[model samples]
Target: MSRHLIYLSILTSLTACAGNSRPAVQQDTTSAITGTDTLNRMVLVPGGTFSMGADDSTGMPDEYPKHSVKVDSFWMDEHEVTNREFAAFVAATGYVTTAEKPISKEELMATLPPGSAEPDSSMLAAGALVFTPPNHAVPFNDVSQWWSFIAGASWQHPEGPGSDIKGRENHPVTQVSWHDAQTYAKWAGKRLPTEAEWEYAARGGLSNQIYPWGSEALTAGKPKANTWNGNFPYKNTHTDGFENTAPVKSYNPNGYQLYDMSGNVWEWVSDLYDARYYAQVENGAANPSGPAKGYDPEDPALEKHVIRGGSYMCSDEYCRGYRVSARMKTTPESGLANLGFRCVRSVTHH
Candidate 1:
């Protein structure tokens, strides 16, 4: 299996949030933007300056060199895009997701090593990665142990041929590539939030906090998010009452009234992934978009986009990506059951 497929599989398998009813985050009326995407249930995120990225002790290098950034106010979805919502976009646009499109020879070879012999065309089929957890514990380095590319899998068939969204209209839609998200956003008159915009809204007016709830303790009396409770892959305690994706708003919203910002599914942002991006903007930037180009040392050949908020597979023992400042990356074409996205619209000035 290719590394791309491997990532999709394991990450998808890892698929699978919070709090009391906090008061609604107040929207700034002084500079109120007009109009609303009533279809998306958007919340107006007040503009503000914030410290972006994370510190050394608790964060990855890509999250280091914590810098300051400012973003203008914008409207963001209160939750991940649900199946019901995405269906409306497709119904209107007849839009086909990347996973629904067959991979061409050129696209396959582009990610492969030079001089590599081409495989049979049959191997290149419309598909998405379905998470197949290993029965036994295995070394984390070789991800192929659990993930496999299922030729028939697409957004409509989350687990491949037999699986369907049947009664999951309220559940967040997964198996959507970044390109697919862009298509949906465009159809809805919105766009993916830039990495900075995402993190800022995710902060929910709190600064330097770990998780969205301002607590590193994954559990305090009751489980905060739908994350793994026991050993990853091999054992899922389901303490949060879910083994996989949960419906949006299954838990409490963040301070910003944003649901599932720290768990449930990994959310794709509009930023290009560059490990050195934080270091480049140490002096602080206003409305800083991500790096112009993408680069990741792990796989320089393939471009990557940033995904945030982690997912259900996130745990204290494994990927603590549930933290607000955590960063992750995958190719734009890589979509899995654990990944989804919300949309944002810039506050237009009259």
Candidate 2:
């Protein structure tokens, strides 16, 4: 059988085991205090300043003109929000994520090229990206290479209608857009962290480190963060103990007690994306929000929003986006298997 089929079988077996158990399974509350819970529940990240952006060596043009940013203290979740926590929110609020809704025929047609096939009826109706290994090489910039507009893919049915969050309760919740994240944040009496705030917290009090763990490569002579460790789009040795998303807080916390700030999943930030936003800030302390209006030439549809802290899919050969300074622009309406979020509050109040 193919690796994908085998993976699906394993997941299916695990799901069955999960579903047979009681809904009120006790989580490791003790670990939660130690900043090691899998629920994406994190200890507060006491925020402070460090250089934001990058020095000349980091190739990305957008990370150019390295600058300083001072961020006030804040209380941040130790990890990205997880399926179990998001399930509670949905159970309480009856919240329906945008990914759960079908794309209208009109909207689908508007987004697709003139000759593209109609949305696949056999696939999950509304789901997020699920990092299935591709049979061939594909472009990273063109999301169509790996992302399938699966139906029935939402916080509940993460892989699609046939899939459920049973065994994956501790996994980070995917298929969540920025709007969905905001809604959950409000419901939880929190809000999305501003990009500055997010970066500062992600730094975990480390100074000028490439990742939350510092300048070491993810492998770093020993198994480190959860990330791809093999050739892209074909094999995943599972060297990091996961081929896709792992349970939240599965790894070590950064210096500031924040978990998964560098990997596992990419997180949403409040700021709108502007490649030049760093340049505009230029070592100043204005605490700037992105442009008042949203459209940018790089992404005309304005669908893209700021996403930081790359996902399990990140690899040195392909996307080194897991770095602390790394930033990616994603569609606000777009949800992917590797995309999830955490909440934050101002230290003074929360």
Candidate 3:
């Protein structure tokens, strides 16, 4: 679909939904080949060795200790899992996302304080975190100021119960938990890309470059990808012509013919996130699949998976996650407005 047409459709849907309701990876080496028609618009990424971490000073601690790693050949979706694509998956399989399933008492208790009483069922309603920007500038340290878990906020109803994905069929599906992504991947006969494979494809054969595109400049000339321009959580210049998610393939593709490798939304990988996993990796590892388990010193209680690329919410003043080497972590069951994913198929060796 054309970008202008998709944008128009989305605007129309947003109005109707509001009026109607109310509210609201991995592998490989030699004999590598690039071929199409293997998957739904798949792009062949002939994997090779590249520096896995960022040496830039802006990199986070977890993205440090740059090392060399190799990946085998694989076919990856050129664009993110769009709302249209996910709809097809659900239509065929009757899948229910984690955001649509009620949170269990056991799950709530796991994260709560000791002896914390389980509240009424009302508190366990199915929901997801929706980004609600504060009216005024607030400290970035407290994320609660802008994020709220709104009931009925799933991929279908992005804003809440009153909202719908009417016009956003082409936009990347958000509010999808990592488990939900895995489920869709399974149904589609594909799997989530490992962190190594993801970075390799995202780099687009550019060794150690800061972004999928050749330039390190976030906004040197025209906006290359969708990202926050003004101060984060306070203002958005919409320099990329999008304040939120854009239609898939709205921008240019990377060297590997993959789109949205940098922004629009954070793409989930199969790897379990561990901040110090890089230090433990054997040098010159081939097709590393990441740590067997997840760990994050910042928040030890939650099990997290690695999310690559960044989202429209990423900003230079705040997140800088849009950088190719930047890394972020979130629990498997937690879904936010800016979290989505793509799928990959491993090349079979004869």
Candidate 4:
């Protein structure tokens, strides 16, 4: 996403993140291997039809006009890909993520509008979006106040130069672009889930429920997912027992035996973001892959992919993105500190 067009998702317009799993480990599996042992870490989401999208308060405009969709059964990761898993991919492929590569003047220009001014050369340095909370609460209109494009920030050094993923191996890997995630999926011989499949799986066989667990609020029960407990973009009450990305399976699993399918980090799915997609798709469409083209009235300069599940930054007064049907979008290159992904495989694939 253009720094100007960041999920500043008009502030990811604070509804932002989900997944499932065992205690995450750097499982002993290779890209070429998709055996039963590896499948153990993945849940088999049964094929079914469900009312997609939500008309509830937590939902955004794109989630309205709820439609029906049918998706086939597929194998899905129980949780967001951990740093441990992503590290294995990097180690095996020596992949250089988009955030690690400097953006050029032309590249930046391409994302800008026709009459936009060119950015300074220094602004083109390699970096990813990092959350910088203020000491106190502030207005919610502008999300740029809390998000910064930090140079030297990448999945390896998530919080920038001095920070590293030393002890966060089990934590979800953030600062990864859609392209980077696609590359990892290809290397693993898997693929990103479609918007339909993701929502269906996120529902966990439930219907019209706000959260994976049910309509109950996150605070009512023992802490459900990792989300901003108090003022967002500033102070996090840590009421969820985590200040940032929590380790996988830190919370209870959903009905589908999937964990962390609501919060922790925003997840990427294989669907172009079309603000009006729900109204457009044929009711009960089977195995929908989203729209043929991307559309975002707010940021029309670049195409965007749908991102699901709110992140740690989500709050009631802000982004209620943790809701099962809540949706967010960002440019394919818009990797942020609170965004990550998981992979899935077709049932037919061995």
Candidate 1 residues 56-129, lDDT tens each? 37788778877788889998888999888888778877999888888777776875779989967666788887
Between candidates 1 and 2, the one scoring higher on lDDT is 1
Root-mean-square deviation (CA) per prediction: 4.2, 9.8, 10.7, 4.3
True-structure lDDT of candidate 3 = 0.77
After superposition, the stretches of candidate 4 with alpha carbons farther than 4 Å from their true spots are 1-40, 55-58, 109-118
lDDT of 3 by residue, 48-73 (tens): 77788984776877887999898998
The list of candidate 3 runs beyond 4 A from truth reads 1-40, 110-114
Off by over 4 Å in 2: 1-42, 106-125, 138-143
Per-residue lDDT tens digits of candidate 2, residues 1-350?
Answer: 11112223223221111001111112223331322234455355544456787632754666766777767766677778888788788888898887776545555556556897765543324555565668777655444445555556677877777888889888888878888999988877678988878877776666777877777768777655778778776778888788888987788877777778877888988887776766677576745555554544443544346788887878887777777888776656666777888887665553
Q: Candidate 4: what lDDT?
A: 0.81
The lDDT values for all models are 0.79, 0.67, 0.77, 0.81
For candidate 2, the per-residue lDDT at 97 reads 87
- Ranking of candidates on lDDT, top first: 4, 1, 3, 2
lDDT at 172 for candidate 4? 92
Q: Tell me how candidate 1 scores on lDDT.
A: 0.79
> How high is the lDDT of residue 241 in model 4?
83
Q: What TM-score, to 2 decimals, does candidate 2 have?
A: 0.81
**Candidate that scores best on lDDT:** 4
Clashing residue pairs, candidate 3?
Answer: 23-162, 24-162, 24-163, 25-192, 25-193, 25-194, 27-72, 28-72
**62: Cα error in model 3, Å:** 0.7
What's the residue-level lDDT of 195 in candidate 4?
A: 91
